[model samples]
Target: MTTYFLDRGGRMTLPGNKFHLRVDGAGGRVAIDVTHRDHQGLSSGRRDRATVSRITQRTIIAAVPGDGAPVFRDGARVALFIESDDEHGSEPLTVEVVQQDVGATFRAELARLTPVGNRIELSVRAPDQLSPRALAAFRTAHELLGARTRPHAVADEIDIAIDTTASMAARLTDGSIPALADLIAGVSRAAGCDLRDVRLLGPLADSIAAEPLGTLADRVAAVVGETGVGIGRSTGVAESGNGDDVVLVVTDAPPVERLDTGPGVRHLVLSEEPIAADAPAQTGIVPAHLTATAVTAPTVPDQDAATLRHLVRGLLAALAARA
Candidate 1:
C-alpha cells in the first residue's frame, strides 16, 4: 500500500509491473490516461461515479474506484498523462518498472525529488553551463526561503534585483551575474515558483524592468555602465504586495540604512558580505559566493577532502608566487 505523489508535469520512475493502484488528482475529476510501453495495452480507467476527494493545491490523494480500477501489468514501462479542467496537457511522464521491492526502491528514488531537484538535474547534465557557486547559492535559498515560505502549488511572486554598479563590472565580465540570474529563473521553472520580473538597478536612476528572461543577460550587459547601486532608493520604490511578494537583491554591497520596500514584502539579500545591522528587521542576507569568473576552472565533481585540499593548496601557492 505504498502511495506515489506527483505535481503537475512531474516525472517519476518506479518499480513493478503488476500493480493495483488508484491514480487521483483534480478532485478525481481529471482525465487519467495511462499507456503501456513496448506495445503493451493497459486499460485506461473510467470516470463515471468514481469516489474522488477534493483536489487541494499540489497535493493529490488517491481516488478509490469501485470495480472501475484499471489493471496495469506485463509492461516494462508505463506513461501517465493527467489533464485538468483547464485542458492543460503535459507530455507523458514514463515510469520504468524494474524488478525490485516497491517501498525500498521508491524510497531511494524519491529522495532525489527535493525542492531543488531541478537544479540538481541541471547540474548533472550541464555543469559547465552555470557556476557551482550559483548552484550552491540557489540550493541554500531553497532550503532557507523557498522550502519554508513557498507553497507547493501557489508560490509567492518573486522579483529579482541585480546590482549593476561600476564595481560589478568584474563579476559581469566573468559571467557570474548572468549565471546567477539564469539559475534563479531556472529554479523557478523547475520548482513551481513565480518570477515576476528582473530589475537592473543603476546609480541615481530608475530600475530597468525586464521580463521573458530569455534575453536578460544581453540586455543587462548592454547598459551595465549606466546602472547604479541605489539599494535604498530601489528598495523603497519596489512595488510588492502584502508580504506575498519576495524581493531578492543580489548585490555585493547592501545599504546600511533601513529600507521600506512596501508592507509585508519579504526581502532577502544575497551577497558575500553581511548586511548592515541598521537594515530593516525583515531583511536578511544569504551568503553567496559569486566571485568566480568565466575563465575559472570548474570544480571536479565528487572530489574527496584530500583532493580538494590539494587543489586549494596549488591555487594558493600559484597566487602567492604570481609575478
Candidate 2:
C-alpha cells in the first residue's frame, strides 16, 4: 500500500489508471478533487469530470471512487482525504489504497492514536456528588484510564460537569459519575486537550477539591459518605469556556437554567432525559447492568467494572461524533 500526505494544493496521481487527486486545506477542512481520465491508446480523451468532496476536520476519512467502479480496477484509484484543524494545516492525513475495507482500516488507525500524557491530575467539585462504586471503579482503573487517548477534531481542553441533584444520586452512587470522569479525562490528552477537570454540580452549592488520580476516589468518598445520595439542593457550576473547550455535562435533569456553561463553547450533554431545546447534542448514559449481556468477557469477572471500561472506549468516539 502506498501512503500519501498532501499539504495545501498538493496533487498525486496513481501510476496505472491515471487516477488524479488534488487536495486543498483551509478553515479547518480539506477540499479534494478526484479526476480520472483514460489515457491508453485511442481512449486518450480526458474524462475531465471534477468530483469535489469536502471533508471537515471532525471527519478525517472520506473515499472517492476512481473510474466510477465499485472496486479498484486497472487505471482506477481511490482517494482518502484526511485533515487536521491546526492553523498551519499540519498533521495532514495519510491516504492509502488497499483491497480490504477502507472504513475498517480507518477505524483501526484512529484507535492507535493514544493521548500524549499518561498521567492526569484529579480536580473535583462537590465531592458529595460522587459515589462509592464509581469512586472504587475510578481508583481501580485510574491509571489505565489516564493513559487513554481521543480521536481527531478534539478541543484544546475538556471539562466535565456532573449533576449532583437528588434524582441523580442513585446514578452517582452506582459509580457512573466517576466512571464518566475517567472516560473523559482518559481521552482528553490525545484530543489535544492536556487539561481536564470534573465539577460536581450540586443543588445547594459547589466546592473544589484536588488530588492524585489513584487516591481521588477515597478523598471524594470520605469527604461526603459511602454514597452520593441526597447530597443537597440541585445547584449548577459556573465555569466559563471558550470555543477551544469541549464541555460535557453529565446530568439527568433536563432544564437547570443555572447550568449555562457559556456562549461559544461546544457543549455535549450526557443524559438519559431530554436536555434543553437549544443544546447542540445529547448522548444517553447507558446503564451497564442492563446491558451486561452485551458486555460479555471471559477475563473480566467484574461485570460492572468491565462495562465501565467498555463505556470508556467509546467516550472519545462519541465526543468526536458530536464535535
Candidate 3:
C-alpha cells in the first residue's frame, strides 16, 4: 500500500467525488447541508456515506468505509476550507461529525468566521469540529496511481527557510546534505513559482534567484559543505520577512535567534530533532510539523537518507497543494 502521511493541515486532490456542504458563519448562525455532486450515484461503496469536516482550520478529508473506518480513494474533490466571514468572529473544525451533532455546531460557527470566509463544507464521518488540536490533518498521500487530469493546487505565494547550522555536519557523513538541497530546489521548480518567491537561507548559502533545480542544489551543497555546522544567528532567514502565505522550514538546527514569522503566515517545519508540543499546527488547517528523530528505515543505508525522502515527499505534497 502507498504510505500515507502529512502535516495536520495538509490537503489532497479529490479525483473522485467529495461532499459539497454549505456553512454560513454569519451572526453565530450555522447551517451545513450536503450538496451532492455529479458522481454521487456512482459512489455506491460505503465510501459514499463518509463525512470529513474542517471545523475551523482547512484540512478537509476524503475516504471510504474500511476496517471500521473510511479509506481514501480517488475521485470527487472536496471543497471545505475556512476563512473569516468578517461579520462573525471565528469557526470550528471537525474531521468526523456523524457519530454526534458536533458537526452542526461547527457549521454554525464556521458560518460566523470573519473577512468573508469561503463557503464551508466537509468530508468527515464524526463530529466535535473542535478536536484537541487547533489544526486539521491532511496526511499527505503520495503520488497519484496513474494519469492526473487535474494538477494539485495549494496556497499561492510560499516562503521556505532552511537553517544552516553546524549540526548539519552529520548529514555530510551520510550524504544527506546534497539530497536535501536537491529536494528544496525541486519543490520550487515544480511549483512553477517566480524565482523570487523561492527564498533560500542558511548558515552557508543565501539567495532568491530562479535557478534550475540542479544548479540550486549545487550551490547549496558548496556553501553548506564548506561552512559545515556551527552555532550562528541565521539573520538572513530571520529577516527574509513573512511575505508568503506558506513558509516551509527545513533544517537540522532551528534558529535560536530572531526569526519573525508573521502571525498570519502558515509555517511547515521538517527537522532532524524533536519539535516542541506548543508549536502551533494548522495555524490554519492541520498539523504543520514533522520530526525525523524517531522515524527510520531499515532498508535505507542510513536513517537520515530515509528521513530525507519522507521530508521531501511531505514538503512536495504541501507545496503542490499551495501551488
Write model 3 residue lDDT over 1-323, tens digit each, in one string: 12222222333222112233333222222223221221122222323233333333333223221222111233212223322222343332232222112221111111111111444432232111211110111111222211233334433445555555555455544544444444444443333222233344544555544244335445555655565555654553534242334565555534444335543233444343455656543211111222232222323235544444455455545454321
Off by over 4 Å in 3: 1-159, 195-205, 208-210, 239-246, 255-259, 263-278, 281-313, 317-323
Q: Backbone collision count in every prediction?
A: 4, 9, 60
TM per candidate comes to: 0.42, 0.41, 0.37
Clashing pairs in 1: 202-227, 202-228, 203-228, 243-264
Q: After superposition, how far is residue 321 of candidate 2 from its true place, in Å?
A: 11
Which scores greater on TM-score, model 1 or model 3? 1
Predicted model with the maximum lDDT: 2
Candidate 1 lDDT, 162-201, residue by residue in tens: 6666655555465555554555554443332446666765
Model 2 gets an lDDT of 0.37
The sequence of per-residue lDDT tens digits that candidate 2 reaches over residues 1-323 is 33554332233322221123332222122223221111011112123222212211121122222233222222322333322222343333334322122220111111101112321111111112223333333233333333445214545455666566676766666655554553444344323243355566664333334324434444444433443545554433534445545556666654545445453233344454544555544455564432342222323357566665555444554444222
What alpha-carbon RMSD in Å does predicted model 3 have with respect to the real structure?
A: 16.1
Report the poorest 10 consecutive residues by lDDT, candidate 3. 130-139
Return the candidate ranking by lDDT, descending.
2, 1, 3
lDDT of 3: 0.34
lDDT of 2 at 77: 26
